[model samples]
Target: MFKTDHRLMGEKEANNSRKNVQMQEINKRPRINLPALRDFLSQFPGKFQRHLKSRFKRPTETEGANRDIFKLKDANFSLEKQMQAWKKNPVWDDDQPPSIEVVVPEGSLCQVNVKTKVGLPPDAVYNIVTDPDNRRVFKNIKEVLSRKVLLDEGSRQIVELEQAAIWRFLWWSGTISVHVLVDQNREDYSMKFKQVKAGFMKRFEGSWRVEPILLDEKLCHPFKPKTLSEYMSCTQCNGRIASKVTLQQLVEPAIVPPPPISWYLRGITARTVEVLINDLVEEAARIKGVSATDLVTTNLNLDQALSNEIQTLDIKERWALRRRNSRVKERKDRF
Candidate 1:
């Protein structure tokens, strides 16, 4: 009887231990609230669609109306005449200098207009601007990562480009990746660009116009005798050309800042326009066989000053160094 009771007690203890182990295993497993989880998952798709819709919405009616003002109906005829006049004569006022105008017509929508003169022929200037491979000339551009021709026919070509650009605002500075579609019209000497995807921009589009100024002798009755003589007897009378370039851009940032920050950004935009025009002028001079020293001094004091300011901003050093390093790496790889 004693042996049987002892065996029964041992059995009872073993069963209790097994029950405890089972309870502990159950405790270790995570208890999920399935209904709450299902509700969250069900809501995710709708929220994601709404978010995407907001970011990628088409341009508003107001923006479309503003853009309509810049559209050209008969581009070929008008551009041809403009080109002929420029090739025939040069017309420029010594008093009028390059200028940039910025207008904010609506919320976060900014328009910038740049008017500048270059000593190169309109055709040369146009060629430089339209060449996708030549984007390294622009100060803000770090690199032209890739360029793919989508459509190419006689005087018109559509290209897609990927570029890296450095953007600086006071103490803030970073690089931006940009994907753009460029429609180039060689006949019109015009190029239009729109950003398809970019890191920091919501929408960016721009147009470039290269106009040659050929003044009719009959229209210069009001100028002084000396001025008239200089204008008429200038070296640019026969294909020695001067080009008037107009750049118009509309841009909106991905995220809008406060009023003070917005003002600061606008100032940066204006300065950027100045730098770009100066770079173009320098490029034109270079094409005409002008020396770098002459290019720097000839009415380019503002450009020099701006260059100095940019250097102080610490943005140029980064990109310049990066480009140098990349060149070195490429050379090494080839070897």
Candidate 2:
């Protein structure tokens, strides 16, 4: 989903020159006196901030060159006297490790919550992941079986989850379950998922912790930025790992929605899909009394139902429709 486009020398030069010309054209135009623009942005929320952050991710040559300026100041700051003073701190000799780390098995369920200083929030993150155009980012994973909103009535929040599977071998593939909840309240936002089943039928569950960190005034600008968010376990069997990135710019426009049933045409998640294929292969082997390989590979259907697309209608709806039919009797029985 995220990739850098490398242009040839000729194309790169032309693009740069074109941008310079456009900038000059804009600068030559009369500017509007909008002192209130800052206030307007300060009041802006949600997608507006995301747009601003996207703009920040782009690095100009001038900004890149400024790293040398910092190098000189850092050289002086790293004095022998300061080094000696830092070494004298007793805390440095403490028993705690410098960083915390943990790893869970491939097929286990885990949950953890973290805090971030700034950058993308839950809704933006959810939008990025669920958006079909961004599906490339999660390529090789299992299909998104479902993404139903958990709270539909007056909750002002929604939980969306996808069940996906992949094909690996004749007897085994992998499957995953991802759930994300976006709350209207700023303080409540989270992403959680698990490798519920795999080729070996292993299960794994994990959650993330997200907290917003406030940047120091001096370091909160375009030239220099700092972030400090607590990324630790809120509740889980093991420790957690996290990746933090500052999205300074949006390289492209947001993706548009695909046609209905597009997902049905292609199973989600390629990596863990082997599980579904393996199931079919096992069945084939049992029927044919031969290795799964004996079956024609071209005939195998990797494109199968996504976990979410399956029928999950409420029982009441089923009964109501059945009552209208004469042959199929509406029963009080419930399954």
Candidate 3:
């Protein structure tokens, strides 16, 4: 008897829920208007004018003096006539030159002490030297926007990226020119950048050259006599110095990788990879110190969160696999 009563109560509740849903559907029916909104707007000029003006200013003036000026209907007017009309108009033109141009002294140089030859490859050095982004990389000036490019005699290779002298005066609007030179062998390249018409704090022109030196025992030894006084100290230190010095070590160039078999390869991959790996390792070592073997790690919560995230990802992947299988089956059926 209790089971029968419970079943009856459930059926009664379901019927009541169905009735409530039907009532909601009936109430959601949209009411219709016989007259449209356009008719109402058309009937009221004052309100329409106020609303239209509020929405859009008619890009023209219709006041006492300006009324004649705005009444011209044709969009295509003669340029000569327009110029004549503009001359007659009483509007001020802001495109006038200043009476006295500001004069600034030119030519400046930055004191750059590159300690490691391996720090800059020829191309990287060239790019930094000629790229417009050099300002940001070397100087950290974001406003160094415009630059000009100079090409070789053959008009092929870029050798220089120069900023104009006007650059400092009108920092944003100044012109910059770059000059590039390519010899018979493309490897023999040269670039020269100077502020031509820019107003820079300092103006400078310089060239980069490669030098080679040989490594000797004296140069390699840490305790070897580096100064003349140390050289005179004793034969022990003096014996470390060798007379046969080669021209390879003093100006040793950074190693660059050869081009890959693919034509798409434009840069030295081995050097880039080595530099990136070294930098990453050094940064990691700096951050981690000697904590690799240490047992007391502080990021337990992060480890747990990562584990949970991976599990959730696995579940989502499984669901996606099932969906993909279903789609494949559907496609097969269609075929």
Clashes of each: 0, 48, 30
Q: Which runs of model 3 end up more than 4 angstroms from their true locations?
A: 1-116, 152-186, 197-203, 210-335
Write down the RMSD of candidate 3 (Cα, Å).
36.8
TM-score of each: 0.55, 0.26, 0.22
**Model 2 C-alpha lDDT per residue in residues 1-335, reported as the tens digit of each score:** 95666667679989999999999999999987687777676678866878877756553433212111121112232223222222332111112211212222222221122222212222234334335333334344456666666565441445455545333322356553443333322123334444323433233333433332221222333424222111111111111111121111001112312322222212222212333223333332333244444432333343333232331223334545656663444342331
The per-residue C-alpha lDDT of model 3 at residue 135 equals 43
Pairs in clash, predicted candidate 1: none
Q: In candidate 1, residue 88 scores what lDDT?
A: 46
Pick the lDDT winner: 1
On the 0 to 100 scale, the lDDT of residue 40 in model 2 is: 74
Task: Please say which candidate is ahead in lDDT: 2 or 3.
Answer: 2
TM-score of the candidate numbered 3? 0.22
lDDT of 3 by residue, 1-335 (tens): 34468888999999999999999998898855547766776779988887887666443421111111122212343223323322332122222211211111122111221212211212223333344454433221334434443445452355333332222211133333422231211233243323333232233333343211111224334544333233223332222110110011011112322222111111111222222223322222232242321322334435434544554565567667878999999999999
